[model samples]
Target: DAGVTQSPTHLIKTRGQHVTLRCSPISGHKSVSWYQQVLGQGPQFIFQYYEKEERGRGNFPDRFSARQFPNYSSELNVNALLLGDSALYLCASSFSERPPYFGPGTRLTVL
Candidate 1:
């Protein structure tokens, strides 16, 4: 079986722009989560959705949002991108609340 998958392996944007990152979970998975990894730092949990509903959220601002689909794939949208927002966006999936399998992540660079 395949692990989680993400799209647009890399992206470049300017400050104040908006961006959307995508993810597809492994087969039979129903929960998806998003994380932000800044250089030299561990991934910071951003959101977790189960059964297409939001179950948890992190300390990020309202500019960050996400949604899980019926098929369990998910998308993370960030508005008003900032230089500080440049990071690797990772997606993880699991059957339940247990540890999740993470995707390679979408690297975003803000100028």
Candidate 2:
């Protein structure tokens, strides 16, 4: 069974630009969540979608958004990004709302 996968292993951008990160959850899973991990800190949850509905959201700003599709794949969009947004964007999946298995993440770098 394939595990969670993320696109563009690395990314670079400038301030105020928009970015979208993609993810595919484990086969047969229905929950997809997004998290942001800075240089020296743990991941901070962003958004979670199950059965294509918004289930939960973290303390992230409106600039951070995500959605899950029928196939359990998901996308995370960050609008008007800031330098502080430069971090690893992780995608996680779970069979239920419990703990999730994570992806390697898309390393985002902003200048």
- TM-scores for the candidates: 0.98, 0.97
In candidate 2, which residue ranges exceed 4 Å CA deviation? none
User: RMSD of model 1, in Å?
Assistant: 0.6
**For every model in order, what is the number of clashing pairs?**
0, 0
C-alpha lDDT of all candidate models, in order: 0.95, 0.93
Q: Candidate 1: worst 10 consecutive residues by lDDT?
A: 92-101
Model 1 C-alpha lDDT per residue in residues 37-66, reported as the tens digit of each score? 999999999999999999999999999999
Please tell me which predicted candidate would have the highest TM-score against the true structure: 1
User: What tens digits encode model 2's per-residue C-alpha lDDT throughout 1-111?
Assistant: 888999989999999999999999999889999999999999999999999999999998998888888888999999998999999999999998678999999999999
